[model samples]
Target chain A: MAVTDEAIEKIKGMIVSGALRPGDRLPKESELASELGLSRNSLREAVRALSLIRILDVRQGDGTYVTSLDPQLLLEAMSFVVDFHRDDTVLEFLAVRRILEPAATAMAASRISEQQIDALSAQLDKLGDSPSVEELVACDLDFHRGIVQSSGNSVLCSLLDGLSGPTTRARIWRGLTQEDAVSRTLHEHRAILAALRDRDGEAARSWATVHIASVEQWLRSTL
Target chain B: MAVTDEAIEKIKGMIVSGALRPGDRLPKESELASELGLSRNSLREAVRALSLIRILDVRQGDGTYVTSLDPQLLLEAMSFVVDFHRDDTVLEFLAVRRILEPAATAMAASRISEQQIDALSAQLDKLGDSPSVEELVACDLDFHRGIVQSSGNSVLCSLLDGLSGPTTRARIWRGLTQEDAVSRTLHEHRAILAALRDRDGEAARSWATVHIASVEQWLRSTL
Candidate 1:
């Protein structure tokens, strides 16, 4: 194996074998490179690879440390991949989100606290009938994100959050805004929240299905 | 921005903007570094990061290049993340798979070629009642992957395949080897294939549900 790859695997093995827990500090670059029998340059390559996957947090001037290794953290690398998705696949990606998010929201319905629902409701209120597409997009992202996180599956929540990335949505909403989109989006959001507020998983599923399908249809037409 | 991250984004932009395509060789490290106004060391760091996620192929002695950028290629990183899923969440992953794979199979039924089906059958024949755990696992992986790929949606097929990685099955099948597992798994494959042959999407979904759920049940029991 190449020295750089050997270094990557050795570090992965340390984590896998429980010798290096999340949040643990890595040895300084020079010392660790010598231990792994690799040049410092090669060892730095391994660290860079891990950091991209959110396995390591390399602070400037500060020492490098293992990240929390949370599912959300690891899957964040997915957004970069998703960004490069073939243009035609955005709808297919949305189809996936439609399946996952509804199921997730249904899961959230049973567990979302009263206060959490209030917070979600407040999120919708924070947006206006006339915010720019950008603010609306950000508001929309966080509102749904709050509900998904309420489901308490960090993996599901993060995957949903990452897939609902800005670049994809900015394009979608840019088109939607031209079609009397604002009220329509807000209306769907209200319906979704109402279903959840009633603690109705089935209703939430139905509403989310319609809600997601509307945007999906819009995206499909644009495509 | 850090020189390394700047390089990462610059390379990604090249792909996104059509300056780079799958299989396109990157500029020589020295050349790229000079162009991007970064040190060679920093550019190497950027290449290393992209390579880990299968975004770049860096063969020894050969120059680094953009990968095929296929969804399957991209989601392979998810396999490593699957390794670290919290114990019970494995079931959640399975639940998501149960949703994805059957839909994938239904899609495949329409698009799958005669030769592919013949090959699938041929693969099934290889897995007799007495195959080793490793062979059965390999067969199982190939069988499902074939169906997913047949869907012709690269993103969906690859993402589902990434979720249904071999390590998880090897871990489960190692334990489920009791109770005629070899035959049972093969039989399930036959049933699913039959549904595909009949072009019965509902039946295909049903068969896969039972097929995967049986494994899920066994896994749950083991857990």
Candidate 2:
């Protein structure tokens, strides 16, 4: 395991140092193994490990190449890890979202276009005054995602996207068990959309913090 | 690839749904493969991939088991992905740190103990009036890490820790080329520590933001 880890670091160092670039094809297996001073077996294992996280592209017949190294591509692996979080950790995760989502929403407000605002409004209308837990959760995810996506920072988008999985479950559970859940959520979404429409970054940031903090409050009492 | 991905998702689903739990040993390979309706080959591949991300523990003699799923273990994969980021992406990554790190430092200010403060002060003093770029970089990493660690949120700690990697390189380059790099950094650290010693979350947050933003400014101009 130590040897495999070392090989992984060596390959990663190559990328960091610009020796192996995004989309660059790796050397022939045996030759590369000798160059890195590792056995062929260790090199193979390292490549397989890197491929698992979408860091390396392993084509069926062609050759393995470094990935585009996009933030979205790299951070996608976080969703897998987020899935393993325990119920208690969900709150810790929510705390993070509370900080990031609002900041992202504020960024979006300064830059979000008219068309995107209408799309968000349309998403809320689709939910109507009352919706099922699934509908509410789906629409809520969409609304928040729309705003964060508009922030135009892919790293922030990816991190929030990954955290959204467990968070979605928490929202669903909140909607089902709480009183006035539907109305409160819709009201909050409306408030957030209003802030965005007015291009009020502070309002958007404040409302977003309020929105997630309410959920966090509920999670705390429930726990 | 599809089959392997499916296998990975199935296993992940088991963990998410509480069917398989942290520290629980998976069933034998043959039985577990059949249970998931997957070929042994695909299951093996899935396990290897999960192991790479520290989601599973594979013993040499014993069977594989679900790991503790601690955020630290899981988020360690992020450092690997972060290593592949290019120069341009480092700014995007820094933008994230600018948000999270300040919030994290504020949290630390309220809760960080005298002992922790002393340790942090000692770390800063160890650099003396003059230190090499490498030593400055190491101390800089340690200073920010100390504050974030004291925040006592492992998920936040993990994210910031992963981000510090690429940021370290940026700092090294800045220190090498820019004037007063060492003194400016040490001064910022002192301000942050003073705020922490005073237990002022807002001040800590403000100073921390100013500290990182300075670097961001330099990065923007450099780029």
Candidate 3:
């Protein structure tokens, strides 16, 4: 095994076994290198890798500490990769989201708080008056995110968020400029909010399915 | 932004803009460092981060190269994070698989080739006679993977496969020691195959929905 990889694994082991909990600070570079039996150069490589995944939070002039280890935070690393995908991959991702978001909505139906439903409705209302492509993109993300957050499935919410990143949203927004995508988007959001308010799992699932399917259909014909 | 992050974005930009093609060999570290206006040490950090996500393939004695950039390959990195979840997170992931795999199965109904079905059948046949727990787990992955690949959506296949990784599978396998799981699993696999062979998209979806939900029910009960 490479010395640097060994250090990465050793540090991961410490975190996994609970020796290094979230928010714990690491030793100084010199001492950590000595303890891990690696040179400072190799240890730096290990730290760099971990930091990229949000496992280790590094700040200039500040000590490195373990991150919160939340699924949402760790999975944010995926956004970088998602940004690199090209045109067809965006629709492909939306198709998968068509499957996931609806399922997540259905799960949220039973448990979505009244406050959460009102919040989503208000976001929809705020989005109703006027929306540019950029505003539509932001609104679309928040509307979906609000429901997924209420699903009580942190990993599901994180993975879904990680998969549909800003770059893809921009592409969709660019495509959505043909018509009043703002109205369509708000309409879909309202339908989903109504389902949640009714506490109807199947209705919520169906609404989300139709909503995303419309977007997917529009994206397909545009391509 | 940090020099390392800028280097990462520059490299990714090159790829996204088609300046770098999939499977293209990257410039030597020294050359790439000079081009990006960063020192070798800084560039190494960028490379390590990309490599972790399978975007860059680094060879020890050889120069670094761009990966195939296949969605399947990139999504594999999620397994590294998936390795850490130890609680109800497993169920959350499975719920995602429950949505995706069935939808993929339904898509496969139209596109799946005769040869593809045969391969899947053969894979199931190998597990027909009550395989060990390890064997069962491997078969389970292969069964779902086969269906997803046939869906003709590489992004969806990769996302579903990455979300339902082996680590989560191992946990479910460890807990499914009862003899009932043996027959129930085989039964479900057969039913799904039957639906596929019949070219019944709805049936395939329904069967898979029931199949995974059974396991999900078991998991929820235990939780």
TM-score of each: 0.92, 0.89, 0.92
Q: Which sequence of candidate numbers ranks them by lDDT, best first?
A: 3, 2, 1
- How high is each candidate's interface RMSD, in Å? 1.8, 2.0, 1.5
Q: List the residue pairs that clash in candidate 1.
A: none
Residue-wise C-alpha lDDT for candidate 2, range B1-223, written one tens digit per residue: 4777788888888888899988999998889889878878667767877888998898867899999999988988788778777778878888999999999999998889999899989888877666666777777777888889889898999888887774556554554544476578678899999999999999999999998898888778777
Better of 1 and 2 by TM-score: 1
The reply for model 3, stretches above 4 Å from the true place, is B128-130
lDDT of 2 at B215: 84
At residue A163, give the lDDT of candidate 3.
Answer: 72
- Candidate 2, which segments miss by more than 4 Å at Cα? A1-7, A25-45, A59-63, A166-171, A174-179, B1-3, B27-43, B61-63, B166-179
Report the candidate with higher DockQ, 1 versus 3. 3
The superposed Cα distance between candidate 1 and the true structure at residue B79, in angstroms, equals 2.0
lDDT of 3 by residue, A1-223 (tens): 8888799889988987789988999998889999999888778888988888788998779888998888888788888778777786787788878888999999999998999888878777776465677787887888888899888888778878977798887877776765566577677788889988999999999999999888888888888
